[model samples]
Target chain A: MDILLALVVAVLLVVGGLFALLAAIGIVRLPDVYTRMHAASKAGTVGSSLMLVAAGLHSGEFATFARAFAGVVFFILTAPVAAHLVAKAAHQAGYRLSRGAVCDDMRDKAKN
Target chain B: MPSAEEKRQRTGLVLPTGFAGLWLLLFCLWLIFNSSLALPILATGVVAATALAWIFTTRSTVWHYVRLTPRTLYHFLAYTGVFFVELVKANVNMLRYVYSPRIDIRPGIVKIRMRLRSPIGRLALANSIALTPGSLVMDVEDDALYVHWLDVRTTDIDEASEMIAGPFEKHLGRVFG
Candidate 1:
């Protein structure tokens, strides 16, 4: 049981860390604020939640699990809202899309 | 039938009907956080949970959204399953786009109409879209939501709405309705 539990924890931590690394690379490589926000929000939230779950499982205590669960819930609730607000602000502040970007329907609507 | 707005307006010292459930949930959380069942710990949990619940039930209009009927519960679970699957798919899609040497993406903003009537439901839909890969909700005007798509595949509003928001809408409608 101990060996299996440790293995699970190790796998989760490694996977979570890889996602976090990917998100970071994405932030550096993505073209614009919108795309970066996508990486940060999706990968960042999932990565952190996975890490929290790993921590909870590793601790093997109910209190730790509860706290970790609460953290996960809080992250899930807030990450998207934060991303939305940031994206809205970027758009409102008139951030330009990348050169290869195809269209801007919102800007077109605003003009009319 | 009392309108939600009217209920909000006519509130007094009387606790909201959801207070009991709220208190119980808070107490459970308290127990989990403390991981203790001693008399003092349990007593503290009850007191704290009660105080918090009293304040929450009195000041917030969120009680209406706290409905947990068995059907809604089932819908909620199903939505969660769908969300996780989409999350993984989104990440994989993004990984491919980000890692590819060509870096080809046809990003655009498209207007999609939302069918949800409840504010919470609409908010959930918007957030879900934002979280999903390849889509970010830029703004919501009236019944239409403006989403910034990483790859704009279709311009037709109906088709786009069905493609982008359709999967989550049915379950959210059931859960939030």
Candidate 2:
């Protein structure tokens, strides 16, 4: 049981770390802020949340797990709202999409 | 407008009805955060929960609408399942996009309409789409939501709405709408 639990923790930590790494790589590699927001909000949230759950599970206590789960809940609920606000602000501030983007339907609506 | 005394009486009437449940929730949250049942903590938790619940009841009518029926509970669970599945799929897609040798994505903004009536329901829909990979909600105006699609597969409003916010809408509608 101890070994199995350790293995689970190790996997969660590694996977979580990999996701965070990917999110960082994405932030550097992506063409524009919007795409970067996607990386940060989606992968980044999962990364931190998984690590939190792993830390909780390592303790092997229900209260610790519940608190960690609450953290996860808070992360998911807020990440998107933050991302949406940033995206809206960027758009409002006239930070247009990179040249790689093919379409922007909001362009006309945003103007008038 | 009502007089100050009338307003006070009205608020007093509203406070007690919603006070207990909110206080219980807040007290439970306090216990979880403290991770203890010590006497001092319990005493403080009770006081803090009561104070916060009283203030909240006096200031807002939002929590009063939250009905805790079994159907809502069931829908909330269903929404959680949908959310986890989407979260996994989101990361898998992100892994592919982030790890690919040369990035090729047709990113664009598309319009989608929300059917949920309540502001909370619409907010939930927006968050669900934004959390999922390949889509981020940029703005919500009236019944319309503008989403930044990482890969612009379709531009039709109805099609995009069905594809992006479809799964969450049904479950959140039951809970919040």
Candidate 3:
């Protein structure tokens, strides 16, 4: 049981770290604010949640697990809302899509 | 002077029915947070939960969304399963895009109509879309949602709605109804 628990924690931490790295690379590589927000919001939230879960599981105490669980729940609830708000604000502030962009329905609507 | 019926309608709760369930849920949350089973802690949990619930139900409009039917419970469990699977898929999709040397993405915004009538249900649907792979809801106007798609598969509104919001809507409908 001890070995199994350690293995689980190791795997979770490694996976979480990899995702966080990917998100960082994506922020630097992606073309615009909107796309970077994607990297920051989804990947970042999931990666952190995974790490928190791993920490909770590693401790093997109910209090630790409870705190970790609360963190996970809070992340899931708040991350997307924050992303939505940022996206809306950026759009309202008149940010343009990347050059490789193919379509713009909002622009078309505004024209009509 | 409003009639008793009018007052009940405004509050939107069936009273004692949902009250018990809400108390139980809040108490469980308290217990989990405290991580204690002592008699003193349990008594405090009960009191705290009850006081919180009573204050919210009486003073706020949140009572309208405090439903606790068995059907909603089942739907909630199922939604949890679906959400996790989609989250994994999203991460994998993003990983591929971030790793590839040659970036090829057809990013655009698309409008999709939602059928959910309840405020809580609509909010859930929007959040689910935002968290899922390759899609973020930029704005919501009436029944329509403006989504910033990482890859614009189609410009058609109906088709886009079916693609982006379809999976989440069914479970949310049942849960929020």
Candidate 4:
């Protein structure tokens, strides 16, 4: 049981760390702010949530696990909302998409 | 379509059910935060949850129409399963883009129709999309959501609606709408 628990913790931590790393790389590599928001919001949220869960599981106490789970829930609920507000503000501020962007329906409709 | 508050009034649960649901949720949240069964904490949890629940459910119209039931609970559990699966898929999708030798993505802001009439449902749908694979919602106008697709598969509004919002709409419809 101890070996199994340790293995699970190790895997979660490693994977979570890798996701955070990926989010960082994406922020550096992705073309524009919008695409980069994708990296920051989705991967960053999951990576942190995983670490929270791993910490919760590692504690082996129901109360500790529950607290950590609440933290994860808090992140999941708030991160997307924050990201949406930032995206909306950026779009409204006239931050344009990159050259690779295929369509801009929001802008097109506003013009029409 | 009637608003959620109107529906709640029509369904005849504007007071007791809504207040009780809010109280229960707030209390659970309180317990989770405190994470203790000690007497003082329990007493404070009860007092705080009730006070907050009353203020929100009665003193303000912001969440006066909220409803919770076993069916909603079941749907919530189901939604959690769906959410985690999509979350993993989202991570994998990012991996494909992040590690590639050449970046190949056709990002776009495409409009998708909103089927869920309730405001809470629409909010949930938008959040789900923002977190899931391939799409990030940029703005929400009446009955339509403008989403920035990391990969633009198609430009047709109906197809995009079917693809992007369809998975979440079914579950959220039952819970919020």
The prediction achieving the highest lDDT against the true structure is: 2
Which ten contiguous residues of candidate 1 chain B have the minimum total lDDT? B1-10
- Residue B175 error for model 3, in Å? 0.8
Pairwise TM-score winner, candidates 1 and 3: 3
Q: Model 4 segments beyond 4 Å from truth? A: B1-17, B59-65
Task: Estimate, for each residue in B33-74, the C-alpha lDDT of model 1 and write its tens digit.
Answer: 788889999999989998999988778756556566799889
Task: Write the residue-wise lDDT of candidate 2 on B1-177 in tens digits.
Answer: 155348668676434445666888899889988898899999999999999999886687655545577999899999989988998999999899889999988899988998988766777788889888689999878889889999988888899899999989899988888
Q: Interface RMSD, candidate 3?
A: 1.1
TM-score, chain A only, candidate 3, equals 0.94
Sort candidate 3 into its docking category: medium
At residue B6, what lDDT does model 3 achieve? 75
The native-contact fractions of the candidates, in order shown, are 0.68, 0.84, 0.71, 0.79
Report the Cα lDDT for residue B106, model 1.
Answer: 85
Worst 10 residues of 2 chain B by lDDT: B12-21
lDDT of 1 by residue, A28-85 (tens): 9888998888889888988899999999999998789889989988788889889889
Q: 2 or 4: which has the higher TM-score?
A: 4
**How high is the lDDT of residue B121 in model 1?**
83
Over the stretch B1-177, how does candidate 3's per-residue lDDT look in tens digits? Answer: 145457679888445324666678788788888888999999999889989877765565544554677888888989888888898988898998989998779899899999988777888888888889899989888889999999888999999999999988898988775
Worst 10 residues of 3 chain B by lDDT: B13-22
Worst 10 residues of 2 chain A by lDDT: A102-111
lDDT tens digits, residues A65-85, model 4?
999999988888898888888
What are the models' TM-scores?
0.88, 0.91, 0.90, 0.92
